[model samples]
Target: MRFARHRTDQGPRLAVLDDEDALIDLDTEPDLPALLAHDGRLRSAGEVALRTRRRVTPWAGADLMAPLDPPTVRDFSTFPEHTAGVVKMLDPDAEIPAEFWEIPAFYFSNPYATVGPHDDVEIPPGCALFDFELEVAAVVGAAGRDLGVEDAADHLAGFVVLNDFSARDVQFHEMRMRLGPAKGKDTATALGAVFVTADELADRRSGPSYDLAMEVRVNGELIGQDRLDNMAWSFAALATYASRGTWIRPGDLLGSGTCQGGCLAELWGRHGRDHLPPLRPGDVVTTSVELLGGTRNRVVPGPPRHEILPWRRP
Candidate 1:
């Protein structure tokens, strides 16, 4: 089932997609007992129209927030296409470390920002190239450390779609100075339409992207797409990597970065506008990934201030 959190006059409640993909109210009798007790005010009201088998507010009508009330967000570099293509840019003979062939690698993304589907994205003014990255993210259900691949399946709470919006200009500039993926990759991030829980997805296993297919379309033009099964690292590996010497609590999020050929930067990048154009007003970008879900966003020029660190300046 496609589960989402929404707001109504009554309060915030939980919602799920019916067989028809319309929103349904799960607040009545059976469903609410346990989820409500555990989730607290974090939950949203249910969609009653589904009970009556009628359409009241379309999925588009409600405010769709990020998939989970995430406590932490870790993004893994598991996309082979992105890795290989980027490496080839610096050296044709470049190769990933032998250790990489074994498992996943990751980095932290801001956790405080709330994102929703179809939300208008603000492209920071100075960026020469604003790009879209299509990826998958998983929610943690169980809290644990020193977990193995055999134990990974039970820890995941659900799955959601992710659009790791990037500013290539700032990213490359910072990297050349031998810095980490700071300032450059952390300015902004987007979450989901809904997070389909573990019970909903079938054939779950350890894989880079859950065998899903994803595509990125800008202003009605198909720009990028890829298959999820092509990953270089599995989710279990990511979980293990993140859990190393740290406590992983329930509600942590692990993201599988852009899939193979998932973005234009891997295909015909840099010299072409298709790969390197600065986003402008009226640009609509849609990320569609199978199983997990999809999201649509429009680009707008960012605010006057060039940059603001997430925390206040000293």
Candidate 2:
């Protein structure tokens, strides 16, 4: 089932995307997190809709929000080709860390900063080089701790296309300080307006990865494309690794990271810095995944640089 969180006169409500592209009110639950928590009952409303076709709203008219605003967003680096491509552009001789292959590494993101499909993303402050990471994200279905790879798949609710908007300048600078990407990332993350339930993807499931085609286009021009199966580590591995003595809560988000050739940073490194211009105000970025759906976002320039950080001031 394709589920989404949409804006109604009352407020954000859970809804199901029907075959006609209409949104049927899933009045069964208050919100997505609550609905997912009650597993068995989650699909009750969809079944009712199929039988009764009630409370249907046109998808074009309904205001959609991020399908699920996760409690905690955990993004991982699982694509070796993406990493290698990035290194080839920035540091040719750099080797993939042995520890990277030993375990799936990830970083937490600001969940509150999520933007819905077709929304405008404000470029991060002090950033001139902006980029996007085309990937897929799994929304955790239930709370779990110390999970094993084999047990992780059962904990997923569904998948959505994820855009990890990036500020390359700020990111590279901060990473040099020995900390992970922060300010460069905390600004924005775009998630699909529609969330595809896990059961919907059963046919494409192969071990831990899905045989899905992922693509990113800028202003209607295709720029990045890759197969989801190219990942060196799987989402199951990422989930299990993340649950090592840590709680993987319902509504938690885990990203597949950038697919190979998924972002400009990798493209710039692989081709040339001038191969494609950095995202500018008025530019539109759209991405789609085979079963997960997609999102379209326009860039809106932020305010000019200011002295919020006195150390950088003259």
- Judging by lDDT against the true structure, name the best candidate: 2
Which stretches of candidate 1 lie above 4 Å from their native place? 26-57, 90-93, 97-99, 204-209, 268-276, 305-314
lDDT of 2 by residue, 1-314 (tens): 99888888888877888888888887665467777887766788777766776677898898888987788899999888788778766686766778778878888888988999889999988999999999899888888899998899889888888999999999888999889788888888999988888889889976558899999999999998999988888888888988999898888899999998899998888788999999999999999999788999999988777766556755
- CA lDDT of each prediction against the hidden true structure: 0.67, 0.86
RMSD of 1: 5.0
lDDT of 1 by residue, 16-97 (tens): 7766565664553222223433543223333343546433345767766564556788888787657776565455676656
Candidate 2: list runs displaced more than 4 Å: 309-314
Pairs that collide, model 2: 89-269
Model 2 clashes, total count: 1
TM-score list, all predictions? 0.81, 0.95
Which number leads on TM-score? 2
